[model samples]
Target chain A: MAIQQFEHGKMTLEQFEILLDTLGTNFDSWPKMKQAEARNLAQTLDGKRLFRGAQKLEMLMMALQSTPQSTSQSVPESSSESPLVNSAVTPCDTQKEAFLEKLADIPRRYQQNSAHLTVCNRMTLFVTQALAVNSDGSRLFSPQRLASQAAAFAAVLAVGILVGITPEETPTGSGEIDLSETWFVASSDFELGE
Target chain B: MPNRDKADDTILVARVCAGDSDAFRLLVIRHGARFRMLAMRFTFDQALAEDVVQEAFISLWLKAGKFDGAKASFTTWFHRIVINKCLDYKRKRQFSALPDGYDRADPAVGPEVKLAADGASNRLKTVLSALSERQKTAVILSYYSGLSNQEAAEVMQMNIKAYESLLVRSRAKMRKMLMAEKDDLFAAFA
Candidate 1:
């Protein structure tokens, strides 16, 4: 496929770079259709350079992963292997047996966890219900409270508008002098006002 | 074989969600080793890795009911759970005296790691430590764990494109840093 794509020239240099960056030079995990294109690109001069960079980064990563194990407890032999650790996948029959021994307790453990999950659900429901209900059995989100909140909000909005519109002092017909509100004033202006 | 295992995982997960502990055991035996491997890659500490696996299993037992087969395979969802635990452990132990989670994961390391330690790795870690936590996590989950960009994004709760960009930048930064310390890395790995 890579050869086919290479002969056909299916991808551009920029697209090739994106593929290199996103999926790396390995076409193993790319889409079936795109793998050929990627592999084809990887063999190119630019692609090889990018691949070398990725390979170096990957090698450094391998070094990071090769940390010394500090634990004393014996671990099951490494049995699961992927394409990356091609040479390392070995059978761990003893580990399988030890693991099987622990398998029996899972039911009891799951039961305990299920019970715990149930308790948590019930507690959550109770708390939510308690929060939304008044002791008098009226809902906290009752229409009456909602209407009162709306009215309070409207009153606040009206006061804000009045303050905004009447930022300067005004004397009314009743001879009542209104003081300027400086809540929204700049600090310097407020200081000058003081 | 992988497809069959994945199918079995789907079945086991369904049963576990329905409160079948037996199915959960099968799930554990089937996936536990792989989970441990992932945890080891992230944390390096054997006990800590074990804890991560345990917490992930417990979460699966409790939350499997929420799994949506139509959306993702059990493998991907479970990946999110385990990686979350790994990252959680990493965050809680963020300021440890150890250079990285790798150090705290083990007290006495093998010899090869020690030889490299005095050279490029320490420098590499210094550059890595300078990265944002999410950036470092993205690299680990993608590069070391071998997750796809999409799967890595799912695990980290980030957009796929965002995760890819993060990996790109992290790798670019590493490339730059390593370029500067070429001789040291050569000595370390040589």
Candidate 2:
């Protein structure tokens, strides 16, 4: 059978992937200049998934504005505190303030943690009990208890075994053992008369 | 947009590294949708994708200062974080549903087929259902999610050559499947 050639053209898979990326960018309305720049930038990154150099620089700019600046420099530092220490403390304070501001926006985090803690506690308790039972010799489940149940079963089995081993009586009673005759034969009076 | 252009990722990383919570939110808003789509392709569940996006953003915040532009693009760095989170989610799900295969097919195909035929988007989903998991992920990430082969490879954590193979196989499969459907349409016309 002849192999059918699809019209993928002379484009390599990488080129096709890049074209697809360009289409996506166009769909997202990235500016013409930015798209051109991004295409050139993508060429450098080649095998990498990240945008490097100026493109990264551009993304960094947008990220910075969205984040708030700290203004804790106005606070007076103690005599023991170094200027470096004060500067470091300012950023931390700013972050804490920002976190508190956004805390109300994330009610689900608290709910999820609480629910997780509850489940974890219950599982921990169950595991502890299971471990305790398996560890302590006296408290551990006894094989004897299981064997006692088996012994009751064995007693019933022994009765069944004895019944099977015993000879059945014939209608003529030929196979029957006569206990009376055996007892009389054992007696001394019959031997003395003889 | 001008304000965005002036601010820069390094500046944002500086702020975030210094522990600026709002900086992190900005990062989230900027890349959340792309990350979400990337995640959705991998997991095929909207809710799980959202969680993956959130986790990715959180890790970005925690590790902002560690981002070195000299090594890679900020976008690449950010996506690496997202992909890892998705992989972790897959791993946890694997352990939780051990022995039960995780194929995403609907159990009630009869009802689903009717539902699928009613809408164009649903029809796309039905077509996507016929693909292998890796092929589906590769195609969706490349076409729908707007990732380049390199980017998709990074997300999938596969080598360039391997990723290319996956893309080739996936595209070939899609072409075959779509062509079959087209032939059926032509037959009906004839």
Candidate 3:
């Protein structure tokens, strides 16, 4: 019908091309009414050239879209053949099985993965188990325990403070130096290089 | 026939949700090659296509519980997932260079024919790669993947009219770009 509209000059060439784009080069693929119109249009002088050009473009586009195997298959054959038609055929059995096998292994692998703990999960489980096994769960936070921990923390802090305030004794013998003496070199004594 | 396929897919997905690996495997066997071809059409590299399909299947497994039969058929939903994976792959590798001889010539082909085919394919790919991402997707989904416009629009999450517009613009752009090549193609036929 769009081609009919085009024949009547009611549709533009661009609009007619959209019908070609959608319905494709094969007249059989177009609507029954439109197929007659399209075929009639093709019989016209200009329409003949347009349809031929469109079919050629379709073939070229198919050549661009086809799998590597199909491209080679069409080369020695007629150019009028559409590579799209050839590539649309299902893949061979061996190739199909290879792709299927790759997918078939996924669920089993996923099952195995979820069944086995990850490293982080294992670490968490180990920590929980160790805590449950070694400690009386209810008494882990008793007042006496908290008091003991606090006292230990205070003693450690005190020791750290004492260490910080206490000066180190100077090394004796050849490494000994007088703390009161100053060893200084003036900047003026050095030469400034260009 | 599609309704029967959809019903079977629904049952398989339900079984998958219930922890049936066999059902999952069956679903994989049924749809794997088709989806692989779809991914290959998008990615153009077999290895990358396999990776895309694998990742999509893995997502399907984890998200099977999320599929609502009321919303979309299993194939349409899965097509969305596969297309998204391809789009994401394209985005991540956007800055990387395409490998040498990406459209490799057949060794069995004559040198002259090989050279011509290779040259034409390379030029076509150059023109194709220059298309905007959505235009490329529209062309691939409509022309290459064999999806009906409705199904492709659903996968693309676009209205039918919008999808058709995209297809029209895509064909127009490709036609303009290949005007010179069109002459050669016609001459060959003549």
Candidate 4:
């Protein structure tokens, strides 16, 4: 039936290649019609070459699976290791142990991050409480709350701008010198000298 | 069986999200070795593979909340993470020296003889490394790691048809490369 389809122009070489890619080179597992069509196609020269290439690919993958894994060596397996890990039977139990040892610190580090976040959260909570129109948390976004939040934001932005524009100065033996003021003073002194 | 694994993974992930380290440990123990093997296929270095797996699991720990089991299986999600780490590692360390005490080919022995003696797996690895990263990934995901085409496509973030097409092109390219070394490969095998 598939051979007839192929012969009748139903299955093109491109479509056959798609099937070959999707279904692999194995004809036996294909649907009966496709199996017949594919087997018939496989007999042709182009089909033969395509099938051979797929077979070689399968063989290469097989060789990879059978290859002696570089990491597989005779190392004692630990008791806590999973059977899935050991099923590969590679001597990676030590590596797994190391991973788990590293994993042990995750919660602590996570808690530390949580602690850091908590401080920020507490600040946010304080500001939120101050902005709250009601203690029961109703009307949290009331007009007054918005005004307060806006004012807080504007104040913070103003402080940031101020800090950003302030010129940095080095403390000398006498004390910190204002470079801008010193320049202005020297210029005035030069004008007076003139 | 897969359903049970999925359920187990879902629960474990939920626990990890709840800050349960023991659940996270179990998850690592169950999947770490296989993940390492997958990484090794990409890096070809045990230590590098370990680092890739470490980075992947660390991301898993830090971003457990991002995973949605309803949309995709945990394994598929984690596979994407590992593959991304492998790709990132490859990009970061594009140039590396040969391992210490590496054996150079003998002047007396022909290249063909040397390749044959190294075995088909090694020769195939050489050919695979010569392919583009996507092609290499297509081969590794489909064949070495035993993922279904659909699953591999999802892991690669490509459509199923595109993944299959990539596999076809990859295999064809590998066959061409092997044929060029036919004297070493086909002759020895034949």
Scored by TM-score, the top model is 4
Which segments of model 2 are wrong by more than 4 Å? A1-194, B1-7, B94-137, B153-162, B177-190
lDDT of 4 by residue, A1-194 (tens): 22333444456666676666556777887667677778888899988777776666666666566544423333223325543343543233444556556644566565423433345444443443443345354664677768999999999999999999997665776656756766577567567553
- Descending-lDDT candidate ranking: 4, 3, 1, 2
* Model 4 local distance difference test score: 0.67
Top DockQ hit: 3
Q: Whole-model lDDT for model 2 versus the true structure?
A: 0.47
Report the lDDT tens digits of candidate 2 across residue range A10-125.
43435533433333323135444344454554565441332222222222222222222201123222223322333444333433333323331232232222232345444443
A57-116: candidate 3 lDDT, tens digit per residue: 687666555534332121112223322244344343344456667787787676533433
Evaluate every candidate with DockQ and list the scores: 0.11, 0.02, 0.13, 0.11
Give the per-residue lDDT digits (tens) of candidate 3, residues B1-190.
5665675677677656656677778777667767877776677666787889998888767656667666887888898888889889988875255533354544545565555555555565666787998998888788666679999998889999899888877877776566545466444323
Model 2 chain A: which ten-residue window has the lowest total lDDT? A64-73
Q: What is the per-residue lDDT of model 1 for residues A82-179, given as tens digits with 9 covering 90 to 100?
A: 12232332223233334433543556665544454565455443433433434465664566877999999999999999988875544676656644
List candidate 3 stretches off by more than 4 Å.
Answer: A1-18, A26-53, A61-96, A112-194, B95-124, B185-190
Off by over 4 Å in 4: A1-22, A30-50, A68-112, A115-194, B99-118, B183-190
lDDT of 4 by residue, B74-113 (tens): 8888998898899999898853654211245344446664
What is candidate 4's CAPRI-style docking category based on DockQ? Answer: incorrect
**What is the TM-score of candidate 4?**
0.61
